[model samples]
Target: MTDALAIATDLMPVLARHAAAADAGAAFPHDSVRALREAGLFGLLVPAEYGGMDGDLADLVDVAAVLAGGCLSTAMIWAMHCQQVDAVVRHAGERLRSDLLPRIAQEGYYLASVTTEPSKGGHLLTASSALLPEDDDLLVRRDAPIVTGGEHADGFLITMRAGPDAAPSDVSLVHLHRDQVEAQVVRDWNAMGMRGTRSVGMTLSGVAASHQVIGQPGGFRAIAVDSMIPAGHLAWSACWLGTARGALDAVVALIRSRHVPSSMSRDSELLRQRLARARIDIELAGGYLALVRDEVLRRRHSGQPLDDRSLQIRIDTVKVACSELTFSAVDRLVQLGGAMIGYQRDAAVPLERHFRDLRSASLNYSNDRLVGAIGTMTLLDGAGRLP
Candidate 1:
């Protein structure tokens, strides 16, 4: 295993140990986060010169999948943080890069995204909040319906209109240190699963230096199209796969430990066949994820633009397919394990937690929206037979 994957593997027990309690209380996994920080995973995507691993998308996928097997919430937090890091490393000005990247590597500074706005919901391409000039800095007061890991983020990458009069699509990304922002929790996070994410609704008032604006004014569309969307989809898909794999492992263990009577031998065989089918689904989802990951890495290495219609369609399809496939696989595994093992909260198997968490995979990004978008893109591309 690569060093990054090994570190993530070693930390799995730590994440698993606290996952239940964290999920029970809907609390952040402090111990798990601490373990990840100490392991230097926060710098997984940072450049080597910045004291990071200098890892690529493949590394992120492997590490995220392993970590998610232990605790989906912790893995998701790390994945989202890495996504923000990618944006900063690629688009942020020299000043912001110099200030945040090193700290993120050495001090394990966690970054949070503040993109979703109340008016626009999950329509991240546009922003309703505008950045106003204040003396020597830019001031922004934005409210988001959901800010994942917001309460614990050391920094924030916020999206806003370039100015009061700028068009909604004329968005800019600004970096704000936690100290520069005053955040008020507007809604508590009480969810069915992935509760440890602490995705609370909050109103944030912050000031950022002029140099902290990443890329150019009205340039956020490019950043999202090029970086955020792909990274988020890939990482989220990995987590869903991991969650399904974890449950499958639990179900297998439960089956192995039980002794079936000869009269039920045929039933046992049927159960094994069902399990095999679920495993096949999981493998298919994983294969597709790997394929997309390699394609993305190839484009990045060759300095090829990622905005190609075909590539975008593949990325979106992978997300939709993986989320749906993994969720279905986990549901089947849960059924095979039966109610006593899968449905009981205190059962030896943890399939119940996995089932609950995986359910959110489809709803988080809303597969319907993605499917509609994919269809529109395909229809608009006259040169396309298939993407």
Candidate 2:
């Protein structure tokens, strides 16, 4: 229920302080996370009864976009936590919900997901971990690469296969508690950008289970289709939208501050074209996000099921468009910027971080796979469409 701009204001200074260290040390943005929790973002997805915002996807988009304006890594980490809570609300049992909801809502506990597997090609399809019957608890081990928020997460929304190899395969989303899971920062993430997210590789070996099971075994796809697709797509789009917005602002400043300026009529036609086209691309993606989000709020969040194949196609298309557009805008900004923004956190630093972070959008295996799935569905009469 917080005003969007207020949230933006709360994060600006917090993002700047840790923005340097995050990239320098390749660490999680602990200060920015503290700021987000103080701003009540950790509870943004849980129910109001438990002192959470109980926000819709539109609210999520607003908060995420604002946070991305400040720090992309912090924003993306919160996005993962947002998805974790959303899944819990839909699929957790009463015992699980009752035990954890209040604790997280009040304490601002950090959360993340450990889903990408080594063999399954960096997505849900090939989960190597198995949740077997271990007397009263579940026993599971998993290997995940590029686990966002892994280094300091209190827990993870782990996706796993169930039963023995000969047993019927069941996929479940289980909460791997901190005590039971071992999340090591195995590799140094000296990337071109988004250093604060601490996206690292995780090796979970026979971890103990926690509350919140996202539906029955072998149901990862259902959890994704039902609870995650709309929300995650919109959230990442908003994150990149923030990046595009920052780039726009930076380029405008660049134009104004530089010598041989446009006002002197010395601005090259090429530069003007790049700026104008970047503007159009950003605005188009913004419009697409706004339009689809309204539909999501009016239909998807109104207790209406989001199962229509056509609607799913719209979701995939919009995601692909926004991601592609944002990346293009960043590229344009960098091309126009030349050598000025090559370094870290300064006038040029935000664009540098944004450029690197924007790449994560389409590179997400699940998101990319959806693009192809939607195309085949449109071309093949929805016979084997995977949404």
Candidate 3:
């Protein structure tokens, strides 16, 4: 096995053991995070100069999928954290990079994304709150309706309007340490799935140092389009794929343990068919993911702008396809498991948790809207062609 894959396989059992308790109690997987920290997974995106693994998209896909197979919440948290790292590496000022990168690499500090505001109505690109200049510092006082991992992160990448009078679309990204920001849990996190994410709404207000702003004014749009969207889409797709795999693995184990003799029953035949279908769906989605991964990395390395509207449309397609296919695979697994899949407390089968988690996949920023976005891009960009 490849070294990265081997590392992921070694960590899966540990993460799987804690997945049940974490889901049941809606608790963060502290142990899982610690394990990942020790494994250098937290530094998977940081450059080697900062003592990180210097890993690429393919590495990220494999690692994220492996972790998601064991625990979706942990995998998601990890993915978002990596996104934050990507932002800092790509755009942060030299002083901030020198100060924070090593800490992230050596200290394993998680960085959270704080961009979704209540007033934005699910549009993460716009920020209602503005960054007010206070003497030498920037004051960012705004209520983020949803800040995933806000309560647990060591720092945050906050988005805000360029100024109090700036348009909502004129947004910028800022880095703030935990001490600089006060995040109150305004909305309780009692979600149907991904409960372990503890993705609660927060009233966030912070003062960032002059050097903390990652890029130029109104630069968040470029970063979001180029780096954040691609990385997040790939990582999320990997996680969903892993979640489906985990569910399938559970069903396969159950089938093996059943020990049915001689001739196979009708139920067994149907189960086999479903299993084959699910596997095929996963493989197809994975093929697309690989294509997207290579294309994105090549574009990035070649200094080609990923700002093309068609490229974004293609990304949306990849994301929606992967998420839907993964959900389909998991649903088939649940059907194959019969009544036993509903037993939430059954330690032998964690299909309920996987089901709950995968249900949130399509709900992430609404797949329907994303498909509509692709259509809009295709129409407006001449012949509605996609990259």
- Residue-pair clashes per candidate, as listed? 0, 3, 1
Instruction: Supply candidate 2's per-residue lDDT for 16.
Output: 61
Worst 10 residues of 3 by lDDT: 258-267
Per-model TM against the reference: 0.96, 0.89, 0.94
> Residue-wise lDDT of candidate 2 within 1-387, one digit each (tens)?
455447766676678667667876778888889878777778787888877777778888887887777777788888878877777777787887776677677777877887777777665544666777777777777777778877777777887876566232367778867777665666656666677887887777655544446577667677787677777888888888887887687667756665533332325788788888899989989898987778777785577776667767777777898889998998887776666653334644466767777887787655568767887777855553322
Q: lDDT tens digits, residues 1-387, model 3?
A: 556678888999888888888888888889998898888888888899998888887888889999998899999999989988888898888999988888888888889888777777667678888999999999988787766777889998988998889999999999889998887889877888888888888887889988998888778888888778888899999999988887777767666666532232336677689889989889988888888888888898898988787678778888999989998887776666666553444735677778788899888877888888888887877654323
Residue 332 lDDT, candidate 2, scale 0-100: 85
Q: Candidate 1 on 1-37: residue-level lDDT in tens?
A: 8999999999988999999998999999999999999
Candidate 2 lDDT? 0.74
By TM-score, the candidates rank as 1, 3, 2
The Cα local distance difference test for each model comes to 0.87, 0.74, 0.83
lDDT of 1: 0.87
- Candidate 2 residue spans exceeding 4 A from truth: 165-169, 207-211, 257-268, 341-349, 366-368, 381-387
What is the overall TM-score of model 2 with all chains considered together?
Answer: 0.89
